[model samples]
Target: MEAAGCSYQFRIALLGDAGVGKTSLLRCYVTGAQGAAEPDPEPTVGVEFYSRALQLPAGLRVKLQLWDTAGQECFRCITRSFYRNMVGVLLVFDVTNRESFEHIQAWHQEVVSTQGPDKVVFLLVGHKCDLSTRCVSSQEAEELAASLGMGFMETSAKSNCNVDLAFNTVTSAIEQALQQGDI
Candidate 1:
């Protein structure tokens, strides 16, 4: 197949406050299944990498290196170093946790400052939409994205809602930027 020879590798980082479902999102997208049905996710101590091959809109095969980072305050230094290597970033926030959503700006700034303004494609994702009790209004999420110059979507890793779409959308944006020589 033509796609077999058209391989490209892109690195993507998942950033947000701890417990914002960054690892859950990565597990869902990479494995096509939701994570264990547990009340709390074990915190990621450092960085974890997952790989998946996706066919782009133009039949180009792209290998995505999805990096899930430790969102705890102590890991900031370690996690910040990985930002420069990322072509795109999924800045995830928990829909139920207002603080997580509010912290998206810090994540956005970290990625932009590390990757440079012109090279990074960012997607603002409000995660955990499956939990109705914690839902943050979509309007708020959209406004944050608009303010930060990023695309926005609400996703539920538990329900598999918009999980794939978020990743694919960011990848497509990155591909388009590359085609235009913008990144």
Candidate 2:
């Protein structure tokens, strides 16, 4: 669906294990970009939708339909149902949580199995860079991203670091892929 004055609208989702900071990251990106007050992180029940209008440096205006998916196993069916229209996925993992990082491939498999690798653009996001108890190193994350053929980024919703960049880069990649008739 097109929004007034928006050039394009893409449905993007954030997926990972529970407590991986997907909701917090989406909240920070939307509110921070809008100049609104940043709120504390909260657990998502099922799925939540947030919209942000972004103007890319390349002059395309995009309205991102950000879907903050519940990472719990119980919500798998609910989240899976929304995958049809999705154009991008932010495969987020908490840097402090080893299991979340380890499960990155499974998360990617789930998405690609549902959407197909060519249908969607992906970005691996290692979140919670503000935390001192880092379990996943930047190099490890970068290496995994390289192996998966997707870009990697580290973000901290608490400190408001790289939240917008993560989303923008993924959107731009999707835009480019779409332009090249890859998606």
Task: Give the per-residue lDDT digits (tens) of candidate 1, residues 1-183.
Answer: 232454788999999999999988999898888754635668998899888888887988888889999999999999988887689999999999998887889888877777788789999999988887776799988988998888999899888999999999999999999899988
Which one is best on lDDT? 2
lDDT by candidate, in order shown: 0.88, 0.89
Q: Candidate 2, residues 40-119: lDDT per residue as tens digits?
A: 55778888999988887888888999999999999999998888889999999999999999999998998888888889
Clashes in model 1: which pairs?
Answer: 96-134
**lDDT for model 2:** 0.89
The list of candidate 2 runs beyond 4 A from truth reads 33-40
Which pairs of residues clash in candidate 2, taking residues 3 or more apart in a chain or in different chains?
Answer: none
Task: Give the candidate number with the greatest TM-score.
Answer: 1
